[model samples]
Target: MIPRMGAGVVRNGRELVKGMSAAVPIAIGYVPIAVAFGVIARQSGLPFAETVLMSMMVFAGASQFMAVQMATAGALGMEIIFATLVLNFRHFIMSLSLMDRLKDVPLLAKGALAFGVTDETFAVAAMDEKGGNGRIHPLYMAGLIAVAYGSWVFGTVVGGLFAGVIPRSISDSMNIALYAMFIALLVPAVRKRWRVGAIALIGMALNALFGLFLSGGWATVLATVAAAGCGTMLMPREEPPAAEKTAG
Candidate 1:
């Protein structure tokens, strides 16, 4: 029993190391964006502590940017919350997909993994060969989450603390960095999947139309839903034949 337990511990540690290793690129990518968020939040009149707190509490990059923009635009509390909710709704689908792959994991671990499921992390996990077997090591996931979370939080704190020393012009220019990051994330996806480009174009057009008639937040939500709904309907679906399915 003692030997078995020892072996289990060693295996778990190795899994964790592998997970952290996989997350290195993601951590590096997050640092600049997290720093940008911190700087922008500070320039938008958020206190240093609040800026860090927002990073800690709401770790989603796009949502954090939206929150800061809405707050600065004099949006109501409910409006900000609703807009953030709509923006993050895709996480629900990501979590559901991971759930099927990680069903063997404990509920507590699943909850923790769910909290850490950012777009980058989800992409990493989904593309992993081990995920093809429908089993993801929880310890490895924990390691990935820990490193990525630490990098983001640390970067936010550093940026917020030093924001006061940055010149006003430079600080103002940092706002564009957020959009640049979004474009960087988008371009690769559009390249890999032509449908992504179509969806994005549709979303942009819908957003413009909606913006002329509705508030910013409402327009964004409506555009997202309309584009996604259209894409789902237009995208092809592959279904296995009924005889093959039964044989399996």
Candidate 2:
């Protein structure tokens, strides 16, 4: 069923392949971060099984790390829960955008698809327009999720088991990988709107200023909120296709 269609059809295999292809960057992108999570989780005194299980269930890198840190600090259960919720609020917005793209699908399909709704998948799927040549195949999302999800889980286990073998020099370098991943993710939007460059610059400036002025983590939240608000306000309107412009 997943192999029979083309780019314009949601069921087309090509679209699925395209989706999977797009997800490749994401798969590679998460490796270092996911490994770092496992490393930190192990270092934090969490049992290996518990660490892996957390990655499996939460499957959310930042929130999982934050939760473990809070837990290790003997923070209250409610505090841990609140922290996780706050960290995951962005995913809720990502999911909402995905829902509109998948509006024509069946409820069961949507429900199942929602399980795979990570930030990476959301970013790729948002590029697909309904009834367009690059229409999103529901199964493509399924396949991409399967691969990316497996990489994350696998990376976590490997990182946890071999955390000791990874040298400090290597571990320190892994942090840069996150910024590279983000740059790749933003490339598409950047291509579409040069104005996005301004948003990113402003957001980074505010983030640095806030981090210097406020407590740790407050800068991230404030800068993100401010940048998103500003980006939305300055977002460019869709221009007519070149062919349409010529016809007119």
Most lDDT-accurate candidate: 1
Instruction: Compute the lDDT of residue 147 as modeled in candidate 2.
Output: 72
Q: Per-prediction TM-score, please?
A: 0.91, 0.66
Off by over 4 Å in 1: 241-248
What is candidate 1's lDDT per residue for 1-248, written digit by digit as tens?
99999999999999999989999999998898788788888988999999998888888989898889877877778877887887799899998888778878888879888989998888888776573585788888888888998899988988898888878788788788778877988899888788888998999999999989887777777888899898898777878999999999
Span of 10 residues, lowest total lDDT, candidate 2: 2-11
List, in order, the clash count of every candidate structure: 0, 2
Give Cα distance to truth, residue 129, candidate 2, Å.
7.9
lDDT for each residue of candidate 2 in 124-213, tens digit (9 for 90 to 100): 777766567444567777777777788889889988999777776776565554566568757887898888888898888988998787
